[model samples]
Target: MSGAHAPAVVFDAVTVRYADSPAPALRSASFVVEEGELAVVAGRTGAGKSTLLGAVNGTVPHFTGGHLSGRVTVAGLDTRTHRPRDLADVVGVVRQDPLAGFVTDTVEEELAYTLEQLAVAPTAMRRRVEEVLDVLGIADLRDAPLSDLSGGQQQRVAIGSVLTAGPRVLVLDEPTSALDPAGAEEVLATLSRLVHDLGLTVVVSEHRLERIVGLADHLLLVHDDGTVTDGEPAALLATAPLAPPVVHLGRWAGWDPLPLTVRAARREARDLRTALETSTPPPGPAVPAPPAAAPVLLEGLGISVRHGDVTAVDGIDLGLAGGEVVALMGRNGSGKSSLLWALHGTGPRSAGAVEVRAGDTTVDPSRESPAQRRRHVGLVPQSAGDLLYLATVDAECRQADHEARAPAGTARGHLDRLAPGIPGDRHPRDLSEGQRLALVVAVQLTAAPDVLLLDEPTRGLDYPAKEALTRLLRRLAEDGAAVLVATHDVEFAAGVADRAVVMAGGAVVADGRARDVLCDSPAFAPQVAKVLSPQRLLTVAEVRRAFAAPPSADGARDLGGAGGGAGGSAPYPVLGGRR
Candidate 1:
């Protein structure tokens, strides 16, 4: 209640240069976030967003060993003078990777760990932990082992742990990146409540702008050049290079005020809808049928993975054809990642037959050596760090090239192509979240395996990076490689995947063409399809393709139409098999 009108966070011409860096990561940046304000930071990957967030808690220069100039103050405490540990009571920083921040084994203990370290009174700590558990709606997970929790649950626990400390300023880095749509909505709604009811000054950074843009009271754009732009969300998004489909549709339709949410777009889309009523634009291409001679790259018969008494993956029969891209989608702990690992033969499988075919040879991946398995079916795990070991990016790529028996720079070449701006001398751990995933993916791709599996490939990627990844995967699929991507990004799935396989309770619930499956599913539909429902429009690109000059004097074009409901009255018939 005190200092309510004061700025909770202030960056006064802050400049940060990391060790051995060519230029400053963040240069001459200045911004102020008032108390109780929900500010969202948006930028491309490796664009100094993390540096800005770290500055608030004094982690950038002090903990990260970066050269800092100028001043950053959180809750009137100068970050330069106060170490992160000292400022922990006022500023709670939750990292992009929840596992990195988790220190305790159980959810309850994790939540209480921060308060315990601060030496808060026993009774106060207990009350705070219980309040956080209920606030995050994770009461059921209080006694659950943190390791056993799914990615989304772990993320919620991480946030709850920080919340238990009762920091005035909450700083989160990509808090909902791993969450499903419903989980993301829940987390954002919780943040909104905190800002409104508790008046917490929440500063969050997210690459998925569509989900957070509308929730933000203020917007800060971190450009790659280390400059910053601060303004209202609608004003910043009007000219932002990377934005959601709804914003794109609003821009294309020339709405007076650009809409950041689907509800806003629906309200402003009446005129556009009327214009498209007369035009019956042809639907986009259907999912291509598998070739007649299509070799089954990877096939699983009666696949099941069990952990203790729980069956993570249960009796799932699936096949991935050459030259096909399939998306594995579901909520947290739905066995999508479990099945990916089991199919790649890395995880423990109680009962399964995983046979991968290359040319005239078909071998069970479960029995093959690591090297042979990499050559046959390469898998990039959800934690990409699992595949990286070398100190530097250059060293890792060289090791990958050597392991694949390729030229010295072959893997490095692949990495450069996948992520162009990544510094070769930088450590893999030093790279951005998106950059690290890209490096691991490119390293695996150097083997040129027949089958490629990626787990949550678009976690921290910006729209442009996601677009690049989409093109890369499509090209790989066209080159006769079988690509299986297990992801929470429904929009990315809608873009790159030909076939979609939805998992629930360790079994395949729905498997069909991307359009047919996503259009009908409420939880999986993209923003564009959600706004322009009943029209089968899935992407902004699809809407652009269907654009035609309206039969009017103003010379405007009919961009798209609206859908009836969440499931959408869109008559896209289901395809393929379902459980």
Candidate 2:
């Protein structure tokens, strides 16, 4: 046990290098995380964030076969002297890929697995399992098969399984990447309570800063060169390489002590909102109007999917025109992934007619062979790594090119564009989550199908990688392909999608322009839209463009001089309080 005044975790001149890689993943990184503090690790994808976290529990050197110099001490126990199993009682880790860590068949059983391994008494184990299930709001899924549960449910179960062990320090990588906005909020709230009420130190790595920034007490930034920096969240984020939309907006508006939450941003955005009262944001990219006789690139009629007695998709009719990007969103388990899989023809589909336009003939995708289907429609599933089986990145690319009958380096070209600098010789399993996702995306694009479906494509991507993906998808749309992205990321949707579709209870509940669908819903709105409500501004780039453009001659107002008053009340009711 650590002394009362000792830090929860300490890294002293620590450096870690894998045998395969030429450079160290972490280079002489030094930091300290005090007990009960919530430290968020922020960095670009594959920028050593995971390497830093793995070091906390000795996974870096012990399990990953990496060379570790210096030392990592957690709760007064040196990681060099403690294997993962030895540190299990003091440190609990929930990795980015939850399913990879699951060992049980059911939710309740999974939660009890960790406790059972620790030899806890049956009475205490049952109590701990119940507490974790209830705390994570997953008690209703206690008896559900782990395979039947949605990705978000699996994430909750993963966290619950760790919580049942009752460790003093918790480490999670992209914990809420699979969850909906509300679900992410609940999980973060639970973590906050654990930190404050239980004095549990938390070190988490997440790409979606908006979801976790407000709850973080400290920030650990890992640079591309493997160096690490730590400080207050706001201060570090103000100049960090990437930040949430709200922070971008705060920086754009010159708000001192940049707001980390929508509530704080709203409080500081009063005058700025008044300044933009008369300026309308520039319109989104123009989607060319399809001719009346043009065939829909992809169409689904009366689609119905079921697993046992549960209806995953219930007789839904949908269509996508060529040269369009659609965002499919909803609460976890609301049928988004199910719908995507059904459309792709691989998942369960009891009833549905999915047709894709192939040249002059329209063909049913479900009736086509996997190879034939790839020629017309392609899909990247939520678990992208599952599609990878090759020994190295070069091998995967080579196979993808061969399967698609494309140029030898075609897939590798796409991968470079999406996430540059990933070594070709590294094994797919060794790459970071985002890198693995990028590789799959590149492989799927090798066929260059007319219709593309991506489920949770941005699961592990940072903002820059997402921007690159956005550009790639836009290029695909411009090339007359139809793209459908099933995602929980509202900001990505706002920026990349031309249309938005919301699903509920296995049916399409809402469908319309992305701006209208996203801005109108409090739960689905992006941080910028939430900060500047009633303006329909969805992104920081939009706001920046709006402010940069010269005033129009017809009643347009200058951003700098629109609101003469020093202080003005927000036009809309203050949105919901802090999450």
Candidate 3:
């Protein structure tokens, strides 16, 4: 361990260049992370954030086969002299895709695998495993199979496996990306406890800054040009290109020393709330009401999905119409994914009937071949990498073009729009999680299915990538494609979905307009909504549009408290229409 006065980790003019890359992944980066501090690494997609974290454990040069100049020292051990395994006792690293790193089949076995490899005593290993299971709130799943666990559960198991190893420095890459809001809070709270109580150092890279910025002691901004800038969280975020909704709200409202959390933003939004009391926002674009006899593009009747004895999706009826985007939301393990898979005709369904209207014919996807099903329905599962089998990005794109009989560069064109600058020759496995998802999305778009299902598509996307995806989905909807996105990202849901469908305990609990459903739920509300509560504002863009317009004649009129009118019956118009 480092001395009391020494920093936990240090980078001295570090530069890493991959064999295939044109420029250095990290160029002359230097920073020191103090002990017990939580440092968040933020950047655009494919901006070398992972490269910086990998350098700390010597994965850059030793494992990734990169040329490294300068030096990285962790816990007083120089990475140039020590490989990842050699520094295992001091540093714990978790990748964005937890399942990729998992070595065991069961949760208990996986958690104990690390300690057993370290040759810890049997009693100690057992005790540590139990402690981690409890700390991560996964004790009930201790004996469960890893394959059966939800994406969020798998993430917790991955974290638990590392914690049992007792590393001093924890480096997590998008640790909470797969988790629900409640689960993410638990994991982040556990990290905070470790930082404050155990004096452990944490360096995490996350796209959703809203969840972690409030707890971050320091921030590292990895620019697109491969340079890294480090400072206090608030100082860096003030001018950072990528920011959460709360920070955007603060900047829009011109609050000095911008607030990073909803609580802080709400505290500073007193005057703005008062100003918005009576001045109603402009109305949204008129949505053409569906005719009483409008035909549903896709319909599921009595859908029931089961895995072993567990009921993932109960009997439920759902319908998707053309030219609509729906956000499927629920806590982790809440049947959202199962329903998507069942609807796509790829997962287990004990009892259900899925019918899709393609052209003039109504067809059941389950009875069709994989290729036949693609023409009517397409699905991009949570593990997007599973869809790729080619050696290089170019090969994957070529295959997708051939399968869909699309133009030669059609898939590549979609990819370029979704996430620009991905090298064609790069192997699919070598791409980051966000890049992999983009590749799959591009491949699926080649089919141009009537209905598109994406599960956790924003798991690894940065803010810009998410915005691009939102625009793509919106365009697809406008082109008369029904889109269903299963996600835990409330912010993305608020921005992209016209309708929100919430599931819980394997059943549909609520379904309504996105603004009404998202703003009404405390657990699912976005930062902007939480900050500007009772006004029903869902996004920073909405708030900006509201304030940009001229104040109404009755702007000073008070309609009860901040809620506006009795029983909140008055409509709060947000920036609407196709986002």
TM-score versus the correct structure, for each prediction: 0.90, 0.90, 0.89
**What is the lDDT, from 0 to 100, of the residue 104 in candidate 3?**
86
After TM-score superposition, the amount by which residue 198's alpha carbon in candidate 2 deviates from its true location, in angstroms, is: 1.2
Q: What is candidate 2's local distance difference test score?
A: 0.83
Query: In candidate 1, residue 306 scores what lDDT?
Result: 94
Tens digit of per-residue lDDT, candidate 1, span 1-579: 233445799999999998778889898999999999999998888889988999999988887897999998887788778899888888888887788778889998999898888999999998999888888789998899998877678877888888888889999999898888888887788889889988899999998888989888999999878999999988877777767768877877778788889899988877766655544354544554677987888999999999899898999999999888899999898998889889988888899799999668799877888888889999887778777888998988888888888888888777777777677788888787778877888788888899999989787888777877777888898899999999989888877887889999999999877877899899999887788777666776666545643434444344342211112112111110000
Q: Which residue ranges in model 2 land beyond 4 Å of their true spot?
A: 1-4, 97-100, 104-111, 122-156, 281-295, 556-579
Which parts of model 3 have CA positions greater than 4 angstroms off? 1-4, 99-111, 122-157, 281-288, 291-295, 550-579
For residues 66-131, what per-residue lDDT tens digits would candidate 3 score against the true structure?
Answer: 799998998888998888888887899888778889998899999999998899999999899999
Q: After superposition, how far is residue 285 of candidate 3 from its true place, in Å?
A: 14
lDDT of 2 by residue, 1-46 (tens): 5555668999999999988677899999999999999999988877
- Cα RMSD of all models vs. native, in order, equals 6.1, 6.4, 5.7
Roughly what TM-score does model 2 have, to 2 decimal places?
A: 0.90
The CA root-mean-square deviation of candidate 1, after full C-alpha superposition on the true structure, stands at 6.1
User: What's the lDDT for all of these models?
Assistant: 0.82, 0.83, 0.83
